[model samples]
Target chain A: MISRLRTALIYVVLGLGALVMVAPFLWMFTTSFRPVAEAFTLPPRWLPGLDSSLESYRRLLASDVPIGRFFWNSTVLATTVTLGYVATTTIAGYAFARLRFPFKNALFALLLVSLMVPIQTTLVPLFLLMRWLGLVDSQWSIIVPGLTGAFAPGMSGVFGIFLMRQFFLTLPKELFEAARVDNAGHFRTFWSIAVPLAGPQIAALSVIIFTMTWNDYFMPLIFLNSVDQMVLPVGIMSIRDPVGNSSATSEVIAAVSLSILPVLLVFLVAQRWIIDSFVRAGVKG
Target chain B: MTSIANDAAAGWFSPQNRKETIAGLLFIAPALIGFAVFVAGPMAATVVLSLMKYDLFSNPSFVGLANFEAMLDDRRLWKVLGNTAFFAVFAVAGNVGLGVVLAVLLNRNMSKTVQYAYRAAYFFPSLVGLIFVAVIWQFLFQRDIGVINYYLGLVGIEPVRWLSSARNALWSVIILDIWKNVGFAMLIATAGLQSISKDYYDAARVDGSSSLRTFWQITLPLLSPTILFLLTMNTIGAFKVFESIVVLTNGGPGDASRSLVMYIYEQGFKSFNMGYASAISLLLLTITVIVTAIQFALSKRWAFYE
Candidate 1:
């Protein structure tokens, strides 16, 4: 009976911490549905009236803020980065794990060292290069930098490569060997055999890429300057300055809610596999 | 047999070897090119740019160490550096501490339903954007109508200026960061905890060791690698903190909560001082490298990698 009480107490304790953990989310979700002034009200309304429920969202969508355009930009940018990252990392990582090439280990070591350097060091130069190339204020500037490299702003290329390599290493060597013995080229074997078996790993990689790209603020904030070019994070910032007048809070909250929901859905549905993939990759922030 | 042995010895470009080399290079070419342009090329350019004053609007002019020398007289730079360090040390400690504690609690024999629920709640913030995190918290930290102040009222404490007061501003940033990141740290710790075999705990139980004693002696040593990993990543993340500060404080009530990266952005973009920004970023890079190197070196004594 004492043990049962202890378990009950532990549950209460754990549940309290979880409440703190999810408080902002709860607040955001609740606030997103109400009028701006309702947020500052004393007891904090948890349930909105049916009329106020979609008021903030409608205000944001219909406002001159161009939020819908931002969402489209984010979607296109994220999808392209995901596809580019998946294609590049899968092939490169596969070669690192399964093929014997000159200076292969050295190249992988170089990738590891590349991860250690922070992006701040490269920011000025990348900006300069983009300006020199006349790509500044273009979406391509944001996309190109994130599309490749070990420390892309959209996602970590080194992590993706390492994940794919680790996954590839687990597949039987004979699968590739069998194809090779039949006079198949590496690409042919990789396409016809290896890629088919790596569905879960690819999905994990794509999920990570998509989410990271969707939330990427730094690259877009720096590389793209136009209102039309704005991605969600930066676009929303333009819409709602932190110390804006009292009337802006609910709309900002609504914008934030819409921005996060897609990634939240992905997280909620795939929490298990996502966490496992992160742990397996020994993820870095 | 002799001919075959000679062929093996002489063939540096055997058909299979050539095929392997060609295919491997072809496969990895995009990654290699990307590394060159984005990472290696920029790194090299950062060094050169630090020695030249080339604002985006101006023609390039060579400056001989003037930017680095200017660092000696820069008051704001020093202040922001100190601010970043304070933020890094506390935020990393708070994150890793909360993460480990939560990980340990969840690792206890518990119902699966409760376990999954708590895990998702903690991890949900990590999925949200940092900018959104600041937006959400900005409401909660509002002095008059804010739920935080409302709760503090019940506890008999006065409402504190969370993001506006210089003394309290950095702490607010740290708190916001720790809240968003604790879940991530917890997830990593949970992963580390799960990997630990059940046999060690069984042995500890049979030995009649107290739970605290078992935790210190067995669990801690075994978990050192994960802790070390958390320390390195969290420290680096804290050093690179940007969007949250941009949204929430904008370096704040004064220059109280400005970070190294924020300063770099201000100099490079705001003031158009590319040369000085490059110099400061090099400082940022050096400090991060030294700190992580120290962490790994220290881990040599305690980390129990399997």
Candidate 2:
């Protein structure tokens, strides 16, 4: 009886915590479907009315704000960056793990050291470099720096390299030895053997990089200047100036709801791999 | 005879070694080039830029120590730094404390479905964009019509201006930050708890130890490393808080919530004080490095490995 009581208590606590975690998102969704006046009601209506207004979403879609363009820009940018990061990090990680090269450890150490340098320190110089290349206000400014993986500490090339290298290091050396004995070169061995076997890591890395790039606000805010070039996060903020002006409140809520859908969908589809990656990374550390 | 023949075939300059070396270099070239141009080069330029006074349009002239000197007398610099420190302390403590509690509660004796559901719900906010997070919380924090104030009014409390008041703005951002990030700490703490062998708990039970005693003596010691890891990471992240502030307050009614990174952005991009911004950036870099080093050093005293 006591054991059963304890179990029930645990469930109650867990349920309440989960509600707190989920309330903001639920509120955002309901408010997106609420009319402006209803949103501002005194008691704060929690339920959508029978009519279920779509005016906010309609205005968001019909406006001259180029919501569709912003979505397209973010999607394309994130996809390109994810693909590029996988290719670069995989090759580099494999080389570091499996092959002997001159000054390899030193170079790898340099990469690790660079990870500690905050992005703010490098922001000015990088911006100047972009301006010199005449890439400011263009998607290339975001994409080019992103290609390097040094744009942010968390999603940088160094982090990906470390993750991939750690994954590759655990593989049996016999596999590579056998491939070498069969007269396979390094590239051939990597593509034929390593690449085929890296399904889980690739999936995890892709999801991580995709979400990071998609949700990125700082880089795009700094680099992209025009409406056509702005990403979703920045574009959403642009639509609702200074946050809570009653006129755009519902519209901004609608936009926020829309902005999170892609990431939420991706999370639902890949929750296992995504959650597992965080756990594994934490345990490894 | 075979060994002799193999030795003869593999000379000082072997084809296999040469091929592997060339392939490795080619494979790592993109990463190396990227590091050089983007990270290393920029890092070097930041130091030089800090020493020169150059706006984007004009030639950068040497201005030795002026920017650094100006930083000392800059009154707003102290305010921003204080705000950043205040934010880092509360945010890190709340996230680490709450994360450990949640992980302990959900670590055992739950159905698989319930476990997954709780994990998903907790982690959902972290996956959303910071801008969206800021917007959602902004709506909920509106003094007149927000859900929070509405609830407070029911309980006979006055409506608090969450983002408008100077004193409340910083705390509001901190609360939003804690809400968004506690899940991450939970995930990390959960991983740590799961890794603790069941044998330890079994041993404690055999000794007839109470649950509280077992947690204090066994679970906490075992979980210290994870706690330390979360502490360091959360501190670094909190110090660099930008997106939430930008979207919600933008340094606010009187610069009450401007973070170091935001100030750097304002100075460099808005005021065109490139030299001053670079100096401030270096200061931020120094603080981050020193704080991280201190945490690692302190972890030695408490974090258990075996």
DockQ of each: 0.63, 0.66
Native-to-model Cα distance after best TM-score fit, residue B214 in candidate 1, in Å: 1.3
Q: What is candidate 1's lDDT per residue for B12-130, written digit by digit as tens? A: 36863677668888898888888888888988899888998978787878998999999989999999999999999999999999998888878886677777888888877887788
Best of the candidates, lDDT: 2
Please give, for residues A43-127, the per-residue lDDT of candidate 1 as tens digits.
7755555646677888787788899899999999888888888888999989998887778899998887766787777899988
Model 2 docking grade = medium
**Candidate 2 wrongly placed segments (more than 4 Å):** A1-3, A47-49, A152-154, A243-247, B1-14
lDDT accuracy of residue A78 in candidate 1: 86
Quantify all predictions' global Cα lDDT against the true fold. 0.82, 0.84
TM-score of chain B of 1: 0.94
lDDT by residue (B1-306, candidate 2, tens digit) is 242122324642365456766787888888888888988899889999999998888999999999999999999998999999999999999999998988888788768878888988988888888888888888789888788998999999999999889999999999999899998899999999989999999999999998889989999999999998899888878888999998778889789899999999999999998988999999888888988898879788868887
TM-score of 2: 0.95
